[model samples]
Target: MSKICGGIFTSHVPGIGKAIAQNLQNDPYWKPFFDGFDPIHRWLAAEKPDVAVVFYNDHGLNFFLDKMPTFAIGAANEYRHEDEGWGIAFARPFQGHADLSWHIIEHVVASEFDPVMCQAMTVDHAVAVPFELCWPGKDAFPTKLIPIAINTVQHPLPSPKRCHDLGKAVGRAIESWGGNEKVVIFGTGGLSHQLEGERAGHINVDYDKFCLRNLAPDPEALLQHDTLDIVELAGSQGVEILNWIAARGALTGSVRELASNYHVPISNTAAATVLLSHSERVLA
Candidate 1:
């Protein structure tokens, strides 16, 4: 049977990508942010999972206000990076795990989570930035990808609890696959900092820490807040916590937080990163 080795929770700020592209890791402004992933890089170098189930939100790259799917899964053979209007050059295409992608899509829908299956999709910073952080270069990208796109840009996003339930379903799907591949899931985005309006640079340090503290052993605690509640407390874009909740839900048994880093004002956001692994007693 396949196994979920672990899950990664990260804040995928576009500026992080720019910092790396500009080779500013040693620069004081970006040093801490870049250093935070050193442990993650070492961990990935050790684990070498065969496939990565990446959960991210597109910042209007593929979907718009006209047609947006609450949940979408990419089943393409390869995924290409997009410009996102920043004039960033596209990265090398990421190989896809079609078999695992189909398995997840089939099981997710069977389990009552309606998901739009995309035969093709373009990944933006939300997806690309994390990959760049974990696997520094294209040669270092160890696993095929299964991109899971969630809708958080528009109103009526999935509730925190709902996202968790969906992740649980995805976990079941990965575990049920007969292949012997190892898989890792990633929940990208959040920590706080609203962009727009008068509160453009608001950062809720207390709430962000509260989430980091309770995320592992008691994720259900976060389910109490609706999307609006998160927006009011963590900031407008703080609703991205749903992605983290979903990734946390994907792991069976309790999680062991391997590493965590939090820094302020990473281009108008509270940047954060966490690495989690399943405890010894996981569902088989």
Candidate 2:
């Protein structure tokens, strides 16, 4: 059976990708944020997971307001990255694990979660930036990818509890797959920041800290807040933490934080990276 190695939760601010493309990692403005990935680099080197199942939000590259699925999973042979007007150089296309993608799609649907299944998908920075952060200086990402997009771009988004439940369902599906591939789950986007409105440029350090503290050990504690509450506290875009919650929910094992970094004002968002290791499946 396939084994889930662990999960990585991080912010996917577009500027990070620009900084990386420009080779600005050691610059004073970018050092702290860039340094956070050191431990993650080491962990990836050691684990060498064969597949990466990414949970991220699409930023107008794949879906728009007229039509967006609450959940979308890719069953493509490969996923291409395109210019999203961010001016960041396009990263190479990522190879896909179509067999595993179909398996997850089938399993989740059987578990009563309806999702859009894509045979071909275009990934935006939400998917590319995290892969770059985790494995820098690579021509192509080492692991085959399965991109699962959640709707954070429109109203009536999935609630925290619902996202968490989806993650749990995905975890079960991964473990039950009849393959020996080692997999890593990625939950990408947001610590806290709003890009527009009167609350624009808002960064809630206290709230971000609260989330970072509880997310790994007691994700249930976060379910206490509804989606509206999150928007109010973390800012409209900050609600992207829903991705983090889902990623955490997927770790159906005894989990412990191996490394974490939280820094403020990275492109006006609270930039954070967390690397968690899972041991022994905790039967659902």
Candidate 3:
């Protein structure tokens, strides 16, 4: 049976992409955030997962406000990246695991969750930036891709509880698959930062810390806040934390934090990275 190795959660701010393009990682302003990945690099080298199921939000590269599904999963042979007017150089196309994608799609639907299935999709910084941070300077990504896009950009978005439930469903789907592939789950975007409106450029350090502290030990604590409450506390754009909440839901095993780093004011967002390892056996 397939094994879920672990999950990595990080912010997907577009400015991070531009920083990589210009080689600004070591620069003082970016050093602390870039340094956070050092332990993640070591962990990836050791665990070496065969597949990556990414939970991220699409930024107009593939979906728009007019027609956005609450959840979408990619089932393509290859996933490409395009400049979504961010001006960051496009990374090489990532190879997709179509077999696994289909398995997940079938399982999730059987489990009573409807998600749009895309055979051809273009990923934006949400997917690309995290990949670069995980395995910097790679000519090609090491793991086969399964991109799951969540609708954090539109109104009536999935509540934190709903996204968490979706992750639980996906986790069960992976464990039930017959393949022996080792998998890693990624939840990208947000700690806290708001853009636009009168409350633009808002950052909630206290609430961000509360989330980072509880995400591993007690994700249930996060679900108490409805989407509107999250907007009030984390700001409108800060609702991206829903992705992290979903990713944490997928770990059915006993989870332990391997490493974590939190820094503020990265592109007007509270930048954070967390590495969590799951036990080999699922907890009952």
Task: List per-prediction Cα lDDT, in the order shown.
Answer: 0.88, 0.91, 0.92
- What TM-score does each of the candidates earn? 0.97, 0.97, 0.97
Q: Which stretches of candidate 2 lie over 4 Å from their true place?
A: 87-89, 282-284
Comparing 1 and 2 by lDDT, which wins? Answer: 2
lDDT of 2: 0.91
Q: Which residue pairs collide, candidate 2?
A: none
Q: Write the per-residue lDDT of candidate 1 for residues 1-284, one digit (tens) a residue.
A: 88888888999999988888888999999988888898888888898889889888889898788879999999998998887887894466789988888999999998999999999888888888888888886474678888998888998999888899999999889989999988888999998979989988889999999999988878889898898999999998888888898888888666888999998879999999999987436366
Stretches > 4 Å off in candidate 3: 280-284
lDDT tens readout by residue for model 3, 217-277: 8999999999999999999878999999989988977899989999998988999999999
**Model 3 lDDT, full chain set:** 0.92
Query: In candidate 2, what are the lDDT values of residues 1-284, reduced to their tens digit?
Result: 99888889999999999899889999999999999999999999999999999999998988977777999999998998987875655657799999999999999999999999999989999999999898889567888899999999888999999999999999889999999999999999999999999889998998999999997789899899999999999999999999999988889888999988999989989999999998765678
lDDT, candidate 2, residue 255?
A: 92
Candidate 1's C-alpha runs over 4 A off are: 138-140, 279-284
lDDT of 3 at 274: 98
Name the 10 consecutive residues with the lowest summed lDDT in model 3.
83-92
